[model samples]
Target: MVIPDLGRSPRPAPPHVGPRPEPGSFRDPANRVFHAGDDVLRALDRTAAADWRALAASSFFPPLLTAGKVCGTEELPAGSPLRELPTAPASSGWATVLRHERVPFVSHPYEWSFAMLRDAALLHLEILRAALPAGFTTKDGSAYNLQWRGTEPVFIDIGSFTPLRDGEPWAGYRQFCQTLLYPLMLGAHLGLAFQPWLRAQVDGIEPEQMGPLFRGTRRLLPGVLTHVHLHGSVQRRSAATSTADVRAQLRDAGYTRELAVATVRGLEKLVRRLDHQPAATHWVDYQHTCGYSGDDRASKERFVLAALSAAGRRRLVLDLGANDGRYARLAARHADYVVAVEQDPAVVDRLYRSLRGEGERHVLPLVMDLADPSPGGGWRGIERASFAARADADTVLALALVHHLAIGRNVPLPEVVACLAGLTAPGGRLVVEFVHPDDPMAARLLANKPDGIFPDYRRDAFETLLAEHGTVEDRLELPSGTRTLYRVALP
Candidate 1:
């Protein structure tokens, strides 16, 4: 189960290497990552060799590891970060160990909301604050490096740390501006979603582009004028020159550590000052307005709680199409962590807002279209992970979700059941809803499609599909109508 975590490089490895370790570990020389069963094996190369040893010895990494914010560094064979790491003869060099976590889940900046992006920004700044005292600085400041462990943002790329050079400008300052600063400011001031802009500008928002985007808001804030407005104008004027003496001008204009820190603090304050007004959209309004009697809602909650009780609360839960996180919060009450997946952009944004409050550390909201989810893209299209690859949950909830896929999207019943089953971790529970064709919601979905594409869209057929994957531990029909809840689990 070895997996390569390269961001977006398309180059194939040449066969000039000594003994190939694992396929996943061969992506970079800086850190040769392997797996010895469930443990992560890191082979430090020249870039990470010295720092790896020193960082491991330091007190900083340990607290983060204990907090589940970063992976723990274990004692491998006494070796230099410059040397090649050992691997089993059967290893393939990229990833060759039978580890529990094959790779990190793919999270794009465009999918994140303002609060999520802000938290990631703060996490990176905190990392900078922590690592700076340890004589290291981050070489990269992309939002992609931040991942959510529940509601908390964690920095996973330890290899991004490099030896700090004094008297030089912050290497990642420009990246910080593009990745975090501009996006936050745009969302706060212009009420932009930031995802579309972020997706189009994968590297980061170019200063030239920022000029036009913020054309209407030139007088909003002093910091925006200093950083984005004026900076963008200067970049536009200097477009033809490659060897422009911009750094000296910036230095003369007082871009010192104190100024940089103050500017960042201002950005932080601005991110917090954002008032995320819930934009009006179909799913955002419809999820609350449509289809469910008071009794039905209560019955669904009872069914979910019962399932959660039977499943145990020590593990993680994945709620597919978790619109606005109504049920996800319920799952969060019982489980250690809950990942709420919703395709509707508006609903996900709203849910992200609810999960951002302080002390809420059990929910993670993701934007994904279940029918055509995010595919592995980037150089050679091998850097990112697909939806199915990231579905490892202790339990899965598919409440009111199947009908949309089964009839609206025309997915087969067996495939729908199998997809829900795929999200379950070992000994995990699957709580799903099966709405008969006669059900109001199911009828509405059927109306969208041609006559009789889903002939097997019956409750019995759904149960049969469940039987093939796991035993149906419990079943209940809501007092409202033909909608039913089933608790299925692998034996």
Candidate 2:
């Protein structure tokens, strides 16, 4: 199949079109991304254009793009109207423009669960393996290059693919270890969460930082000996050596393409075998243990469905603190896309696996703490957007979440209401549940806090704050009289 090309337009180019340059896309000089309204366009220099030509012609490209492993791409013929955008790199004139299929939402590795990151790593390796036989390979291994289409991972940076060179080691090997392999190993072997580390260091965990974590017998784990222990030792020894010198040495030592292929194969096998079975957390089995009777549970579900129906069809839905994605699955029936944000990694992992197994493609599960969500990070803190910046859901389901933030996290009721209001799109609806202070669950949350510290944690206070924030469209108290649900519409 040939790549689709939009021929040059007969009409004149738009005057002073201002396409916003992606702040995170500046690292690569050969190709850069720009957003012109709804279109996601990539500007390719002469060299990158050549690479794109090779990629478009490759036999593997069509199949991967068809299978959704790679982003759907089409070339804009030379002199196309989009080429004249103001944000196009003027220093080096672009030879061609390519448009990519936009993902529903952009999420970072730090916000992903263990399974999500592992799957992304496997997809990266799969792409490398597929490209090797066709004389092409990825130039970089960054977790950022991968984005999710619900439960599926798609490689977005088509510019990373290039014709392979003879006797050159895998350029992305160290990067693969740093970003993908080490993070997975940290979770699988140590049962430690890698999200915070990744959030702290966008470049990912280095071998030096990871090696010392494994002590004594732990160093003998499947990939630890070579990838972590010895790799760190080598990096420490070569700290002063120039990268050019290392490449020259490897070339002189006869490191062949076959070696790179073998490395890719080995990494794939190792990654596939790695698994993290986290110890049971409080929220992992919340659906079964949430203390809701049959009637109460059914009533809650009916209320949520009614709220969703009242809102009509939604472009996007947010399920904050989605315990096991029960309501996220429900919201999916009424929305184009649903983002299920849960703080517990294990719970999110289970949700992701179940969605992947069932071939569900509408609900995207994410591991994020509502108390401390993802922030603006990377170069100048604008390269990667904050969670609040990315979230603008038309329908937000904040079920069984307010108590956690207020009583558990100590966030005031007004602040919680304001935060939820900020997440709702203009003229959108928020379905939030407020657990009464006398409820068993709320009592458990308040058990450790000093007595009378949260006297204002009353239903009246919450409703007053909600009224101040938006119009209360509907309200329902559960049969148990322990929880109240409100469907508020933002002005």
Candidate 3:
């Protein structure tokens, strides 16, 4: 397959964007989040406001920020620091606003690799363990509460932190299993890709979902009996019980604070021990099948380095179709951070694991099909920003990518150029490679198409289309003139 790492717009600030109540905010009465340009502002009502004020003054919150376990938070009084916020609800019930350190990139669980999900689970467990000692526990433990800052998984929901009551069962335990544990197991143990299910079932793969996947002998795997099979059975039995009655029964059955700790510990151990031997995929070994000779590959690498140097002091970089992230890692050296998007789940997991420790300090790989970018969803369309709206980069590396997009996805070349150009900040650079008609990969991509459909997809036409969207700074040819790389700046 010809590889183009598949990888949007701006309008008015909200109130124009509607009530702009972020999706899922209605579930919690404490606060609501609003996206105002680059800042993530959370408007807190009286209950959440009081909680924030107390948490801000305490010693507990400081350590997590210092340790990078949580996002940096600043209290913004309505009229003081935040002179104006367009998305705030008009009601005077709100007490204050919080300006959270924007996570460099916001990704969904469906977009994550197995390693990313595993790390997120551990992060959640760590927060629970840490908070319990501080006289609090996260009341809501959805995987969405976390976002990636390079390779680091940092907790983003300031509202999830609520006081813990003694002898209360972990409210998020079932959610943790459904979202984190079951999905991790599905991938690590069953060799299945959990992303599709995650995308379809945003609430996550439930015990019942796993129950069908595991039958008879396969049900004997570690934690499968208690967390999936039997748990699903118990959940089915408890369907008729009221929440208050269940609580009372749990209290009577000795489900205390100690059990809560034990539960978190058990989940943590299972999460840490979970491992996946990733199966080989067509594109995971990108360099081998990417149709590049050693010297030609090195030529593209040098071209990318030159582009980054020209772009200079890039705060953000993007690697589209970053199969195993060879170029994303190279871009990471030049930018403060990088988001690498790939379509193959196995490929994403490979790169995600490679980014551990020092490698993780700069690169975050996500599973996103280039043809279909993530869209805004939830309460209003604005709750989640489309990938196009949020993934702006100072420099973008679209190496070996456009041919597949134009040929594989049937997107017009000019439209493809414009789509990529829009992702770049004005004055930002795109180092995009064009695989010519004669290149083997390009021919393979074109084989399925009817003739004359993409007649304008040639190098000269590519330069013209690029000129329509941005200024072509330089063009570097590799593959002995069959494939060429264009460095362009958006108009």
Candidate 4:
């Protein structure tokens, strides 16, 4: 495989078995992403090929990619596999195809903490500001166009860029307002958490929806007054307005080139000042109560490091139930990137903020429930990916997490092992903690349940299930005697 500017990534690209259309790339008719072997190729439509030419000549792409502001992209070779697809258009019509460097892991906006969302909002505006001088603008401002690279947010969708035109209201103005600004305002000013709302609606809070949430005096805030309340009022009253008429009005309403810059600057200022003090949650300080003595913690850390080393030190690591990211940080020391996912948003928000404040570019904190994980359900039933489908980590860590799923959640032992196995890539390592039923934590979890539910809950039985998929590389019994760590190698 060819290495690129992003440095070495432990997660290998998918093998180019043949040209397969990417499910989520269908909405943008201007371009479609295809997977040929391990490479992600974006085939431009006849209309978009010319747009690509314009973007390439803008002098904006090179610096952005070099500085890691945008996703790294390369022009596809003349004989690239785009021609192999049965639906390939006439080769003479289109002139370019773009290949994007695949992100190690794709976490959705719903999974991001407040800080992560805030950073994405700022980055979106940054791109808008930078591209203005180049005479280009993003046609769509969906949060999905941005992805996490370490702790920094980077724009990924090149197809979203389009040439700016005079006297036209920004096509994506409403989109930026709804997807980025509104959510931050809701969380920062209204003190409402964004996770639940963002989780339920991937498109983010709308002006009509968020505007109504602001009560009396809060609605008077400058940002809320203009972007939310006024915009929503206008949107509601435009039901009977003809699309052409509305366009005509916007065209004549002095939406000059400078107006676009002014709009972006206003949004940037508003987003930059947004803030909220996350309230403390039960799991926020749970890591401190861990009775894992110095020896236990030290032993656990050693075991995890060894497991990563065994796996060729994979760049991507997924930690399920990463409360405060204790093991997540340890994993990050050896891996290129570690995704610390916890069900509690408050804890995740704090951990995310900490990582950002320290400029640690190796960990991404996200919210995810082990019991009811995210599913794939969007446009054409594939715009969003299920957690299991996208979690292709080279090594999966589940320290102090299995008991929550097995006893607390009442999930079967074999099912739990299978789920963990599915999360790890084939031949990848699985580092997990097995809490015996006799342990205080496990006993408390099963206190309300009947004993007959978990017949194979013992460590011996757990190892048996793990053996079905991978060999046990190493297993350690902590000094506390309540927990055991296993580094299993999947076949």
Q: List the residue pairs that clash in candidate 2.
A: none
Question: CA lDDT of 207 in candidate 3?
Answer: 82
> Model 3 over residues 1-491: C-alpha lDDT tens digits?
01111121122244444334456565776677766664567878777878777666666777777777887788765466452544345556667778777666778888888888999999999988877766677877788888887778888888877776666667787878877888889887888888777776657788866888888888888889888988898889989998777878888888777677778899899888888867887887767887788779888889888898886668789999888788898887788778999988889887877787554677889988888877765446654567898787888889888988999999988888888998997778988999999899988877888988888888889888888888889888885678899899876
Task: Tell me the TM-score of each prediction against the true structure.
Answer: 0.76, 0.94, 0.88, 0.91
Ranking by TM-score: 2, 4, 3, 1
Clashes of 1: 14
Identify the runs in model 4 with alpha carbons over 4 angstroms from their true place.
1-4, 9-17, 77-93, 239-244, 447-456
Per-residue CA lDDT of model 1 for 279-382, tens digit only, reads: 66778876666688889889889989989987555356788888878888888778767778887666876777667764566678887778876665444444
Worst 10 residues of 3 by lDDT: 1-10
Q: Residue 190 lDDT in model 4?
A: 73
Residue-level error in angstroms, candidate 4, position 257? 1.2
lDDT score, residue 10, model 1? 20
List the global CA lDDT of all models: 0.68, 0.87, 0.79, 0.80
Candidate 2: tens digits of C-alpha lDDT, residues 152-202: 998999999999876666778888888889999999999899999999987
Q: Which stretches of candidate 2 lie over 4 Å from their true place?
A: 1-17, 87-90, 237-245
TM-score, cand. 1? 0.76
Evaluated at residue 491, the lDDT of candidate 4 is: 77
